[model samples]
Target: MHVTAADGWRLPAGPVRRWTLRPAAVGEPVVLSVNQRNHLAGVVAGQPSVWLAADLPAGSVPGIEAPTDLLDGLLARHAALRTAVAPGDGTGAVLHAPDGLVWVEDDVVRAGTSSDATSAVRDLLDRACHPLAPGPPVAAALVGAGAAARFVLAGDHLVLDAWSVALLASELGTPRALPAAPAFPALAARWAAEPALPPDDARLHAWLAFLDGLDQALPTFPLDLGTAPGERFPQRTLVVPFLDAATVAALDDLGRPEGASAYAAVLLALGRAVRAQRDEPAATALPLLVPVGTRRTEEERATVGWCTTTVPLVVAATDDLRATGERLRAALALGSVPLDQVLGSLPRPLRRTRADVFMVSWIDYRRLPTVPAGTNHVSNVTEADDVQLWLSRTDAGVAVRARIPDHPPAVAVVTALLERWVAEVALLLR
Candidate 1:
């Protein structure tokens, strides 16, 4: 799902109500997947959650007066909701049973002006969405009244990853009808049972070399963010509508001739944009940590968990779309492995780098059911020192959002870099 900061979305005038997940039985000890452990590696002091806001279809808001059995059953079905993980270096996880597990009471929230309603919902989310909170880590709030309304689900990233949110849109359509899938704990246990790629495996070697080629550090914004190491600043969300439907179609048609794809075209554009901002040698490879999904079966895809991995992609500073496409294919072929495991293989210094170096998340909405036009995935506001670019392609077109350091210079440079990125994409029309 395409996610931006909460600022891009807010519900219209309406009464607010909340649905909280109430745990019933004592949780059972479970193993945390490497990815889960990595996400929960260090302690986060404040309210930590990933917010998802959906603009419902004509009948999407199943009920309004009180929590519906549909929703309750839906919550029980997904194991991710009941899985609890605490911050630590060890395998600390507990999966609460989902039978009579959650309770969503009709708690009325004060409604003010339209803006005020959004603020109240956000405040509720901040108060309720701790991963280690009572019951499940998720909480929901319904806004507006009538057949068509909006809802937001905020929870820890441990439960909802990028793919989970996308699948969530479909699940909301018919939660009970979703494919039967393994519990998140089962997935974690299965992963633990698999033999990890040996230290000398090709995939691990390629990943390690990727870090080494980049000055022995995770990839940084090619330009200066004007911050010292470990120094974080407020982040600015710059949403750039980079491509329209016809334009994206044109990108596809144009690249199709050389066995290239829109993804490679974007990489070509991004590589060009980065080189435009500063003088870099042609031999330089722009290192990016691209997320690789781990769901190999339909059962896994239908399940909710952090079933994703990351690999370092080195996009060369060249305009050849086919070559770029080949590199991307090769990078992904490095296979899916917990990003933490890969980082653990690095030198001590690189191991201690920011959790995100430079991450680029790309999702195409065609894979999901047709969601309402205004549907958006929202992220919690946290101090960000590293730049992460989210690229989402929907029926409307392609959109780019960047979480950049909030300093003026960083903002200006990122703004200009993205502007050039848009221009570069346009040059594809030629």
Candidate 2:
């Protein structure tokens, strides 16, 4: 399976050199579940952050060698990686096995030069980040030469989530013979057949009423960008290393005494920062969309796909951090309902505007099993129109990454917002 780029760089042919992966059974087309449908809808609606990527350290890359073994093993074991979505009679999507499972390419300019590694990897990643066609969604490649070489994997978010990345990272070197978990198609079938549980009426009513009070629009961070119609917004990211290892531990200790998790504390601090920066009325409610994982059991965690939903977390402008934390926890607990169900319950107009709200996501990277020694995991960024505040718990403590619209005003304002967010986090921990 030696694949050579047009420029003559050879890719380490994977183990499946002679045969394509054939589905065991392929009679009826698998219907896309409600969750899968929502994901597709997001893509159709122009949400740009639809890819996940990871970079793993490579040992001495002896000119011709690549991580073909690792990539081959992963595709062979993970059925979800081989799945694809195709239109089904204009009704919905039908899931099926793609003709190919993985796409590999080579980017090393020459055999021994490391200077082109970073740019080459970036170019590979950018190409892999685009939306998947009606074929395999995963892409991989080896970049750089010798000691500086690294392997990178990129997949469509529709089929691979952050958990899948972590799972693959854990199993990279040591292939474990774990029990076979339900594949994505099986899970989708089960989810589609499951009866919808009634949402909490009281909570739903309160949420709708809250939105009504806001005139069905949430306040965005003040920016001075000129009003233009249909201009494509560029994306900018601001990374802030605001917490050290000791500070993270202390913050955890401070929150633990109050029955608050680190995430809740961070949310509270973000709420406070928003209030301070916007100088909103004390009664103003800032709506935040937080992603809650749908994988509840161990088996579900082992399964791959976009297993998450964004739920509204409305934070009131107040001084009571404890109360805010309690509210956030409760909201997250009640956010287990599928996103389609949530949108279905809302009015048509509100449903259209729901995704316009800001987003806050926290990833505790420490929970991921350590990869092989010398192999560091690099995070990938997805471009989105909404103001997104991502908090990562890394070895250095808490790292804040803000993804914002690339308009001049939005960039400037978001930079200040993140600065204020760091200060608020410091104040809370102190």
Candidate 3:
């Protein structure tokens, strides 16, 4: 339980329950970091809690004293929020278990203020929803100063898959619905009890076997540390934009030539595009990481929490965009086929596969809820903070947290690339 100050406010001794959902296949092969994995699990299984920190402005009156009671009530309503791991059980192979409970300390956005009182209120309310350390299942941070609150959530890849974080964000600031969330134990039981169809089960089993077949051939992605001159160099970020409707349509059309979805086509196209950008030779191996949603039955879809596995699609860079797209589509068509069986097949390697970025990932959020379509539409709503990039690429997206120093004005470059990418796709579809 280490504590520190950020901006101006100090974090109080508060507890937050953060949930870590894992795929059943990874349950038996624990190989991730101990402090981040079991340490979190122990925290969740025993006492799920977190500390929050913030910096307050002097002379600015606190509009709402921190909602201590509301937060407590929230804890009471989400049982998973109250659980923690049994001691000595949070390390080594055990980390690969389906989920982990982390006790995070407040260490998100440091300095920043809102512009107006109303904005500040909204900002505070949002912060109240996130706990410090192991932060929220996703990434979260505050921007600007008092009265003009803007926040960011950088959800952990393992804990939040696309729409999951958005659902959690929808609950910020309000009193949590009562009766605590259903326990993970019950959820696990339901998963174990689900009836398995023989054919589908066999398909899944085969998928797992296939993944095992590629243990030695899958390409690994090196982390994108950025092209900086030296350590202690300024931080820079690439602003990536998402595809437009037309681009999506074009991708769909591209796939239709071979019976694949736009997403799968885009994945393949992007691989080719990236390879082209680097002037890589044909046959360059690019491993594409795609998160598979394995909540089989419709009933399981609404069950919140992470239930996804990262499956890598290794393809050789080719000169033909259509050829590359078809290859990707074909791979995905069969790649994500039997998710459970895939997990069960190569228990140990799957853990490594997740951390291996050797390629970027796709996170789709088209089906996410959107504030009921027309609830209190504030027409002139404006944010009183620096403009930020909101890049969307199919199912996955990432925001440029901050501009890196000593770079080629990356913000503009990245944003331009994103816009072009979306426009190109949209135009092609049209």
Best by lDDT: 1
Q: Write the per-residue lDDT of candidate 2 for residues 77-189, one digit (tens) a residue.
A: 66667665554422243444433443444423442333344445445545554444545456665654445445556676767776676666556545456555567767777
Residues 125-149 of candidate 3 have per-residue lDDT tens digits of 2333322222222222334434433
Model 1, span 240-270: residue lDDT tens: 7878889889989888987888988988888
TM-score of each prediction: 0.91, 0.80, 0.51
Q: What lDDT is reached at residue 163 by model 2?
A: 67
Between 1 and 3, whose lDDT is larger? 1
Q: What's the ranking of the predictions by TM-score, best on top?
A: 1, 2, 3
How many residue-pair clashes does candidate 2 contain? 0
**425 in model 1: Cα distance from truth in Å?**
1.8
Candidate order by lDDT, decreasing, is 1, 2, 3
Lowest lDDT block of 10, candidate 1: 43-52
Residue 110 deviation, candidate 1, in Å?
2.5
Report the Cα lDDT for candidate 1: 0.71
